[model samples]
Structures are given as C-alpha cells and as structure tokens.
Target: MSEAYDLFVIGGGINGAGIARDAAGRGMKVLLVEKDDLASHTSSASTKLVHGGLRYLEQFEFRLVGESLREREVLLANAPHIIWPLRFVLPHVKGMRPKWMLQLGLAIYDRLGGKKTLPGSHRLDLRKAPHQAILQDSLKSGFEYADCWVEDSRLVVLTAMDAEARGATVLTRTECTALERHADSWTATLEGDGGKRTIEAACVVNAAGPWVDTVARTALGSGTPAHLRLVKGSHIIVPRAYPGDHAYIFQQPDKRIVFAIPYERDFTLIGTTDMLYEGDLDRVEISAEERAYLREAVTRYFRSGVTEEDIVSTYAGVRPLYEDKAASNSTVTRDYVFEVEAEGGAPILSVYGGKITTYRKLAEHALEKLAGHIDVPGEGWTADAPLPGGDMKDGDFAHFLWEASERHPWIPPEMLLRLARAYGTRLDIVVGEASSLEGLGEYLGGDLYEAELTYLATHEYARSAEDVLWRRSKLALHLPQDAILAVGAWFDARREAATP
Candidate 1:
C-alpha cells in the first residue's frame, strides 16, 4: 500500500486508542501503531477506581476533579459492564483530617457534576457499623462513599475496537522508528509483521504514554524534548482477606492513602506505592522496599492483615507525569498536558500525563487542539458513541445478561458472565447456538474457553495468550500456572501455523 492517511498515531494505550476512536468518527483516516500490545504500559496498571480523585481536593484542582467527575457518570452510561458502582470505606483515624472536613470533601464530591445514581457519602460509627469489620482495632470511626471500578486494560482495547469499526487502523506490535516532515505532509516509517512500510499524514499524535519524550526526540526530531516526570506506581494482588463487597481506603501518617479493592472473584488488589522514579520505562519494576511499603500500609488498617507471604502477584507501571517536580510524590499532578508542534509542516501532538479515569475527556480535548492542521469534521462524537461491545439497552448490561440466559439456556453461568462482560450486547457472537458447556469449545481454564479465545483472535486482534488472560480478561488470576502455560503453548503453535 502507498503512504497515505490524515493522521498517524503512535502508541496503543487508552489515550492513543481514544484519540483514534474520536478522530476516525470525524471522518479522518487514522493509523495507530504500537511497539507492543495495547494497554501494555501505564494504561493497564492503575488503581482501578473511576473516582473524582477526592484526594485532589487538597491540591486545589477543583476544575480537573469536577470535569473528571462529570465524565465518570458519562462513562458509566457508556460502558456499564466493565465499569460499575463501588463503595469505599475510609477508616477514620484520630490523627487524620477531622471528621467534618473529610465529610466536606465527600459532600462536595457527592454534589459535584449534578450527581445521580451514585449514593452520597455518610459518616460511620466503627463501634456499631459493619464498615468497621475490616478496620484495625485502634481505629474507631470511619466514612463510606461511592466510586466506580473499572477493568482498566479492557477499556483501552474496547476504545481501539471502536476506533477500528469507525475506520481507524489499529496496529499492535508495530513500531514507528522515524518521521520526516515534508512541505505539506509528514512521512513516517514503521516496522512490523507487515514488514517495513512508509505512511504519509497531515499530523502525528504521540500518545506513547511513557514514551512521549522519546517519540518527540527520536521519531519526529522535534529537538526540544518535552518535560516528563516519571513516577513508579506498583500494585500487589493477594487472596481476599475481608468479608463483604466494599473496598477500603486507609490513610497513612504521611497523609498518603492506600486502597484494598475486591478484585476478580476471590482476590483483593492492594497497592500503589508512588515514589519518584528515574529508571527506564521499559524496565519498570516493583522494588522490595516498595512491596514492603504497600504491605505495611495494608497491615496497618485491615484487621485481616497482609504480609509479603500473602501476595500472589505484583505489577509496576511508570506514570508519564508532566514535569513539575513537587516536594513529594503525592503532590505531583495527575491531570494531562498536550503540546502541538506544526513546524511549518504537519502538526505533531504529544500527550504528557493523564490517568485512566480522565482518558475519554482527554481524548476529546486533545483532538480539539488539532483544529487547523489535522482535519476534523467538527466538535466531538465519542461521548455518545458506544465503545465496542458497550451497545446495549439503556447502556445496561444486567438486563442484557438476563435476556441472554433465556436464549442460551444450556450455557454455564461462568460462560455467560464472561460473555456479558467482554462483549456486552454482542454476547451472541461468542456463545452462538451452543446448547451446553461442551458446545462452547474446549475449556482452557477457569472462565476461559476455546470459543471465547477464537472470537478474541478473529475480532479483537488478540495475538498472544497474555492478550486474553491478562488484558482481555483476568482469567489468569483464577487459572493454574500449568493451565496458563498450556494456553500460551496453544496460541504460539496457532500463530506459527498461520505465519506468512
């Protein structure tokens, strides 16, 4: 194919995928390339809460918090399956902020963005309420509030799928090595399974997340490297340690807080140690000290208690925070920043910092910056567009699931739940006319079957077993190690057989 496109996007994270979805809907031809799989970087590694960043209230970021909170309701309406209501219990410590002040923050949160659906926050008496069941004995009071939980990595994949359906080319495992701006357009070089190819475009978007500065300096040769502050955030997964479905957020003496969230079916996600990082993004790792920090924080608040032995898995991500070094890691900004460089040719837009919760709005705002250079139809369209499988009645998945069960009466409950969450109204595509568990194809492991794998392979562009187990679904958390290896082997052989 000859070099041609209106826009060329580098990176496959949520920002890149969201931008591709937005621009394509406006009738622009887009090609998004990523060196690895989608959501392979910071996009997948998150605390997994779609809150308004209540802690940000102390940082005087009301505008950002409010805008994000508004999008929260919109996202819930858009993707109800993977994103749903979650309650959080913030155990009140004597030395922490006064009860009235904490209530003020929640009250503002509960009222911000014309609140609806979500329940308001309430003060708790640890001596009498069930919220105190998981609290350490020293704590006597607490508060309960609402936020939404998300399948972070799947959100990126769904956005890319939506973009592809809207006429954008989403390329995973494709690397953009260099670019040169001509008189009116830019030529970019990419290397991948499609072999070396050249693409021409009116503009380039560097939504490389952690690789933003590198793309600016190396590919587009912008000369001046944009400022970037990399902060390493790590999470640990442990067996469920408490009863009930609500999550817990505990305050530390340093004013930093930690979360213990119900994850998968029988696990709790405890994490996120934020420490200034100077390491290479490709080699981000959870330090032993960081693990100790997370475990210590969990132990301090949860009456069930957790130690290093309790941890089953750990993941670390490098936050591509915009360079504004603060006195502490907690003070660094989570809001996103964009820089556009036209340079007498095609404009190149670079995204610096952002979080999972604010991705959709960030995508809308980034496209707004490319007005004259990169052609867009008008305003925005993604706020109403359904993301991949998110199209359902009233954007409600529960109702869809109930109706699907009647259609496939013999299908197991496990298969039905997976289908509903991953494909929403399109569950039929995976289940088809299967009369029972056997008809769904071979069972790879817990909640994973050959039918779902084949559908992901043919439609969602899943190239490896990890794409299914880790990103597309969290089945890896339930499957045995041997079963995971078996599935990996199966996919590898299939890929080799289909090699061109």
Candidate 2:
C-alpha cells in the first residue's frame, strides 16, 4: 500500500463515497474507510426520495429547496435506471395552508432546477381524475408534482464502486481507531478484517455521519463546538396498501405531513417521524409508540389502516442535520456544514449534514472547501461524468430496457427490466451469455439467482450472504427464513472452498 494519499475519507455513506469518487476521478489518490459495510448506517435508512422538499418553503428555507431541486435533476440524469421520476399528489386539507401557496411552491419547484427531461409539476383535481379512486371523498382537490426516487443504499455502493473503478482504495469494515499529525501529513490507524494497519494521507476528511463529532472531538482531539444534530427518523414497510401508482402526501393536524409511497415491486412504504434523538447510534430503534404514531398517521389519511402486524420491516436512521437549535426536530435545517481544522502541518476536514438528494453537489462543494488546505490541481468532473453502468444514451432508461429485453429474450420481461434498472449497462455482466432460465443457475430466493450471486461475490465486494441478500439485493424480504439459512450455508461453503 502507498504510504500517503491525496485524500482519506472516514465514512462510506453517500457524502464520503461521493467525495472519494469525485476526487479519484480527478486524479487524486484517495482512500475511503468505512467502519461497517458500506451504507450500513443511515445512508440505507432514508426515505429514499430525491425531492425539492415542498414543505421547506413553509420554513422559508428557499436556498435549501432551490439547491435540492437543482440536485434532483442532476441525480436523475446521472442514474436514470435507479433514480427515476415519482409523482406526489398533495391533497388539500380544510385547515392547512392555502392552495395558491402550494401552487406557488410548485411553480418555484419547477423553475428552480434546469430541468430537461423529467416533466414539470402541474395541478390536478383529485375528485375528477382516476387518482380519485385511491383517495377518500374528503380529498376533493390536489396538485400533482414531480420528484425522483432512489435505491438509497445501492446508490452509496455504486458511488464507492465508481470510485474504486477510477483508482480509489475502498476499505470497508475498517475502524478508524486514532489519528496522529505528522509533519505535513496525517497518519490514521485503521483495523479491519485484515487486522491493524496505518495509512498516511495529505488530508483527513471526517465524514463519519453520526460519528462526525466523535471523530472530530474524541479521535482527532479537536473541540470546536459540535456542529451536528442527530435527529432520528424511522420508517415502516408493509405489503402494498393501496392500488395506485401515485404516492400521497397527507397533512396532519399538527402541521406535519406523512407520506404513503409505493415501494419495491409489491410493497408500500410509510414513514418517517422527525423526533430528536439523544441516544447511542447503535441503540436507535423504533419504539412501539413511534410505530403507533406512523401507523396512526397513515390510518388517518387513507381508508386503509396499517397495524403492527402489517409492518414487514422497520428501520431507524439518525440524520446528522446541521445543528440549528430549533425546537421542533422537523424545523431543523437540512443544510450541511463543514469545519476545517488546520493546526501545525495537518488538516482535518469534517462534514456535518446532508441529504441523499443533494449528495452529489455536496461532494463537489466539499472538495472545493477542502482544496485550500491541501494543494491539489484538478477540476471537478462529477457533474458531467456518469456513474458506473450509467452511461445510457441521452439518459434514456426506457430505450435501454427495450434493448436489454431484445438481447435477453429468455429472461422474463419484468426480470430483464429490473436488471437493466439496477445494473444499467452492466446488466450484461450479470446476465452473461445465458440463453435460458437454466443458465442462470439455482433460484435461492427472491429474484436472486446463483449467477447473479456469483457476480456479486466476485465483482461487487459482497463478503457474506447477508451482504448479498440484505444489502446488495432485498432477497431477505422475499425469501423464507429457512431459504436464507440455506443460502448462508451455500455462501459459507463457497467462501471456504476459495480460501487458501
């Protein structure tokens, strides 16, 4: 391994992974270390939407909204297969803000971004349209708007994959134990599956998400007043509750809004409560009360009610929102803040807060901020460059899917389309020279096949069956417990066979 690098990123979430990719692409030797598997933390536990935050307008956070709206378009363009358009139907309520105000917000949302391909926002009468069939009678009028949906965790992995492809060293399951400032550089102690090792870098970036302040204060011995607020957001997943393609935004009595979105191929995702989190990151779990709150919130809006029994899975994530000292967690600023600690000869750059929607721009701006401390001579190239498997023509996902279908005639249409969506042009590597379903090998669970599993294990840095089943693919959701156990056994046998 090299003794020193141009950059060292301390997390594997969206921000760190993105910065690593951008820097590596710019000819900077970079190293990214994540304590756990990539995106195992809050990056995977998001609402998984690229939105302009229509609600932010009410908080007068026009700057954040405008930036997010612009970012939404960029992200949608770069990863058209995984990041696609979503329409949200906001039903007007009796006691909430005026319709004209929502319309104004929609107008601002449309124009704030330099939109080229995705359709802009428009008004809709819920009672007069087919969407009415999905809603109750009280929702008479509403407006339909555009946003993008993303597979949040996969996006992080893809970013890391792209960084590695561009010659960045990615080390997961590596804990940053300590940092020592040497002359003109920083040496970091990292211990992972391969055991303890020391790596040196010109600059150290602390993008540890929830552990940002810990790295700054505890690890690096810098006490400059914590710049982050860890607010806990929880989400629940259930089998598809409603039969509509469009998502719903319901206004609650407390001025908070709840979203009921379509998820996966056969499930509905409802969530997210903004509550202040004052506990350990490892201990952040959805309380029974919080589950009731989410279920009740959804139950109030739609005719259907989701009880505890309906939730197939629950996840909680702590957003390291830039500390705003706001009373309501919902009112906390979603903007990011950076602190550069340059003392003597070394610099430690720390990233505080960011959203999945703005991660790309966040990375570009982050590098721009850290450029002054470290003498670097490269321009940012992330905005224009496509991510791995994402160099589609005109970013036309539909055309690409049709082409993939034509090439792989034996694969089911839905299966082919899904592969094209997830892997983009890289689907060729996953499907290989298969001419029939039998060529794909055994169906372990979900839509997973032995061919895809082998590809993931060999190419995508998948270490275990959980890495393949849970994170790489949501086969755990579709597979029975016994099946998962069998897959785990198979992975163990395969790994052992390869071991020296």
lDDT by residue for model 1 (288-380), tens: 999999889988877767888889988899888887767788878889999888876778899988888888899889888888665677778
Worst 10 residues of 1 by lDDT: 218-227
lDDT at 74, model 1: 82
Q: Write the per-residue lDDT of candidate 2 for residues 149-207, one digit (tens) a residue.
A: 88887889899999999999999889989888876788888889788989889998889
Off by over 4 Å in 2: none
TM-score against native, each model: 0.97, 0.96
Each prediction's whole-model lDDT (CA): 0.85, 0.84
> Which is the leading candidate under lDDT?
1
What is the Å distance of residue 412 in model 2 from its true position? 1.5
Candidate 2 TM-score, C-alpha based = 0.96
Q: lDDT of candidate 2 vs native? A: 0.84
Residue pairs with colliding backbones in model 1 are: none
- Model 2, residue 274: displacement in angstroms? 0.9
Model 2 residue 4 distance off true place after TM-score fit, in angstroms? 1.4
